[model samples]
Target: MKVRVFVTPKKGVLDPQGVVIETGLRQLGFAGADQVRVGKVIDLVVHTDDRDDASARVHAMCKTFLTNPVIEDYTFTLDEAP
Candidate 1:
């Protein structure tokens, strides 16, 4: 199975990196871009044929190591390997 995870800072949390990127964009003549927030997308393959089991495992992974539950939020999707 394939799993895709998206991790991002929680709302109201100060994102210094995001701020820098936003500032850089405006300086480079990107006027329409605003409130740019940076996040991460992780893609990996898990050896499982059952969707439920794969989802459960991925959820566990997220809670245990993938996300910093206090200041970050995460979401994941599971699919059959292509």
Candidate 2:
């Protein structure tokens, strides 16, 4: 099975990295660039017979170990192997 995870800051969380990038863009004459948000994506592949269980495991991994739910949010999608 293949899993794709997307992690991002919550709506109210402040993203300093994004703010720095936005400021840099503005300083570089990209005045139209405003309110930048940064995110991360991770892909995992595993051999599995039960896709449902694999999906649950990946979701748990994100919620428990990969992301901090207070400031970060994550969602994952699972794909069956070919």
Candidate 3:
């Protein structure tokens, strides 16, 4: 299976990186941009039956280490391997 994880700053958190990118975009004449938020994505391939066990393990890893809950929130999507 392929796992895709997205991690982004919380709504109330300050996003300096996003702000910088947005500024650069404006300077480049991209007026269509209003807001930009920087985030992280992780893609991984794992073999399993897609059972609760495998999903639980992945979630645990994400919670305990893969992300920091203090300023970042995360979500994931799973799909069959290609």
Candidate 4:
């Protein structure tokens, strides 16, 4: 199975990278670009036939290593591999 993970900073947490990007956007004439947050997209291949099991394993992976639960939140989607 192919799994996609989206990790992002929690609300109210300070995002220095986001702040810098937003400031740069304003300086470059992108006034409408607001609340810019930089995050990561992780793509993984899990060897599994069961969607539920794959999701469970991916969740565990996120909780154990892929994310910082205190300051970052994550969500994932699963798709069958070709």
Question: How many steric clashes does model 3 contain?
Answer: 0
Candidate 1, residue 75: the lDDT equals 91
lDDT for model 2, please.
0.87
What is residue 79's positional error in candidate 4, in angstroms? Answer: 1.2
lDDT of each: 0.91, 0.87, 0.86, 0.94
lDDT of 4 by residue, 7-34 (tens): 9999999999999999999999987879
| Candidate 2: tens digits of C-alpha lDDT, residues 26-46 | 899987878898988988885
Which ten contiguous residues of candidate 4 have the minimum total lDDT? 31-40
Leading candidate by lDDT: 4
The parts of candidate 1 lying over 4 Å away from their true place are: none
lDDT by residue for model 3 over 1-82, one digit each (tens)? 7788899999989999999999999999999997799999988876786656667877887899989899999888888757
Off by over 4 Å in 2: none
lDDT (C-alpha) at residue 70 in model 1? 96
Would you estimate the TM-scores of all the predictions?
Answer: 0.94, 0.83, 0.90, 0.94
For model 3, the stretches where C-alpha displacement exceeds 4 angstroms are: none
lDDT of 1 by residue, 1-82 (tens): 8899999999999999999999999999989998888889999998989998889898999999989999999998887857
| Error at 52, model 1, angstroms | 0.7
lDDT of 3: 0.86
Q: What is the lDDT of residue 76 in candidate 2?
A: 82
